[model samples]
Target: SAVISQKPSRDICQRGTSLTIQCQVDSQVTMMFWYRQQPGQSLTLIATANQGSEATYESGFVIDKFPISRPNLTFSTLTVSNMSPEDSSIYLCSVLFSGGGFFGPGTRLTVL
Candidate 1:
């Protein structure tokens, strides 16, 4: 099993600003993923961050908007740039663990 931790568990940001969230795992895992959940909505995968390669973003997401970095096996970060009210959501970091998936507590962002 694995445990995930995220920084800035919740924050309020201004429009046009940016916020960087950090994710750390207790143990090395083969797959780490980022997700976003809008108000009253389901989780949407943002990207898959590999240990030594570029992050693979989902169809509606672009690297420039949501840049990710996975420097090693148990650490990663996601930066949300040029924030807006629409960008306000709960961002989560997940890791594959023992054939199941475990997620961080999540970062709740409220853009003004």
Candidate 2:
């Protein structure tokens, strides 16, 4: 299992602004994923980031809006760009390890 941590647990930003969320894992992982959870909704896979490669985003999400970077096995970042009020949600990073998935505490964002 890997211990995960996220920075700026929560933030309030104005519309059209952007925010970058950081994820740190305790151990090396082959693949890392980013997810978004809207209010009262389940977690939705945003993108899959692998070291040394471009991130693969899920349907309804694009690289221009949600960019991801996996610099190494243990570190990754997801940025929400040109955020709007509808973008307010909790963003999380996760990794599959030893047949199980571990996720960070989550970065809560509220776009005004």
Candidate 3:
């Protein structure tokens, strides 16, 4: 199993502000995944960041909106650009598991 950690358990930010969340892993991994859980919605994949390469974002997400960086094999970051009320969601860090994937506690953001 992979252990993951994220910063800022929760936050209240003004609209139009940006927040960068960090993710760290206990061990190096080939692919690190970012996800979003918006209240009643299911987990949606934001992007896949592999070491030494650019991050591949999923549909409905773009690099400008959710810029990602994987400086190393065990660390990655996601920034929500010009956040709005709709951007208020639980951001999560995930890694592939034997059966599926595991996620971190998550960062709860509220845009006021």
Tens-digit lDDT track for model 3 on 7-89? 98889999999999999999888899999999899989999999999999899999999999999989999999899999999
**Stronger candidate by lDDT (2 vs 3):** 2
Q: Write the per-residue lDDT of candidate 2 for residues 24-107, one digit (tens) a residue.
A: 999988899999999999999999999999999899999999999899989999999999999999999999976789899999
lDDT of 1 at 83: 97
Candidate 1 has an lDDT of 0.95
Deviation from native of the Cα of residue 85 in model 1, angstroms? 0.4
* Per-model tally of clashing residue pairs: 0, 0, 0
What is the lDDT of every predicted structure here? 0.95, 0.95, 0.92
Worst 10 contiguous positions by lDDT, candidate 2: 94-103
TM-score of each: 0.97, 0.97, 0.96
Candidate 2 yields a Cα-based lDDT of: 0.95
Q: Which pairs of residues collide in candidate 1?
A: none
